[model samples]
Target: MDLGTSLINVALLAMLFVVAVAIIRMRSLFAIVMLAGAYSLLSATWFVVLDAVDVAFTEAAVGAGISTALMLGAMLLTSRTAKSERAILGVVPFLVCVLTGAVLIYATIDLPALGDAASAANSHVGAQYLERVQADTGVPNVVTAVLASYRGFDTLGETCVIFAAGVAVVLLLGFGERSLSARSDKGRSRKESK
Candidate 1:
């Protein structure tokens, strides 16, 4: 189990890295959104292999599902293809990404390997969610207890973010329709003048 899950986790982590590169390289906004979703799914798999089920579920929901859906919908409402240029994002994003990856790797170096007995994550507040949830928050199942009681505020914040995204998408949908029509009209006039 250890070797199998470790391999899966590492493979998914590599996929996440590749998808990040692909997202940057993709020319279509729709393709970029889809690649972002693939990255999220890979990250969720990594979280699951690291035994962080709660975080994985949240990431899968917001990142892979809702966020991706909204982004793709917005892309469809906007441009069919993204504008391409030969320019890169300067050097800042690459530098920041390298620094962040280095920091994460350095931080993990001292941590227990996956499935290790001394894995502090497995012995943390998650156990309380499983064992003493009825006493702690009056819920029997740990998932329900955590979502309903412990992290209710965080979920509410996520809901607010989704609501804001919906509003923004609505505005973009209206504006994009108008822009598309105007572009079509201009194209027709240009051809007629020719």
Candidate 2:
């Protein structure tokens, strides 16, 4: 990658780190939700910089869009401010996190450098997709072709999973006016019978 792109990536990552710290330090649930959305958008920007436009689009739509909306909807059923509770700093959890991060970093040491043309990813199916996507799928956009045609089943399954999660959240939150009315009716009947 060019120096400019590298700088951009570093800046974005730094901003994400700052946002994460702010999120963890904040007590307001509303602010935390907003920061989480911002985090998703920043991640989407990073994906774009890496030339993963399809992944960026999915992140923006699902992460920044649907996720934020669903969280806000759920927030409507709860207090805006987070409840103050005793903070517990568990040594085991902290140690586990550190060890996991260390292991992940060590694992990347053997991976090929980013954008290496002869890397396994580029040499394997990626090149074939880039070369044959137009003729095979007749889709000009390689990303779209690969996502919609080559990996259609996987994409469809992901979409279904996301849709199911959204539906489940809505149901769990009891968001509709009908459910609220039904709850009120039940409460009234119980009061009258009592």
Candidate 3:
């Protein structure tokens, strides 16, 4: 409602759109990857304007950091720096675009407005949590109270899942410089052993 917040939201949206265009139009693989990071940052800022701080944090970390790193690493391991040099005049791509756009438009239609008060998401267990929070939970920060206390087990499980995902990515990426160098050295030394 405040003028500053409104201006910030507008700026965030504009930046998001600009980054989206940059990502789409970029030719350099590295530049495109960095633009994807910029897009994630803008998206996270937009999420923050919507009061989704948790979602924003996840987007900033997982979406921007880890995802961009994975993508760039994959680019390093592969030779294809750009997509196939195919034109978009074909019926198959046209049908796909139309279907995709229609699905997205329908999704936008069903989405709750920016600040709709009566939306089910706004009035659901979130409201219930705020209503009986003091008496039921005796905690101050409801989000922390919910994640660390009420849903502690679920949070623990989710944290474990995230850790597992990180480990999996490490394994898939063959890890970092030290391990990679050691592998090369080991390969060379194995010939000496033989």
Collision count for each candidate, in order: 0, 0, 0
Candidate 1 local accuracy as lDDT?
0.82
Best by lDDT: 2
**What is the clash count of model 2?**
0
Query: For residues 22-106, could you state the per-residue lDDT of candidate 2 as single tens digits?
Result: 9988989999999999999999999999988888998999899989998998898889998777889999999999999999999
- Error at 172, model 3, angstroms: 4.6
TM-score of 2: 0.82
Off by over 4 Å in 1: 87-101, 110-131, 151-194
- Models 1 onward score TM values of 0.64, 0.82, 0.72
Better of 1 and 3 by TM-score: 3
Whole-model lDDT per candidate: 0.82, 0.92, 0.85
- Greater lDDT among 2 and 3 belongs to 2
Candidate RMSDs in Å, in order, are 6.3, 4.8, 4.6
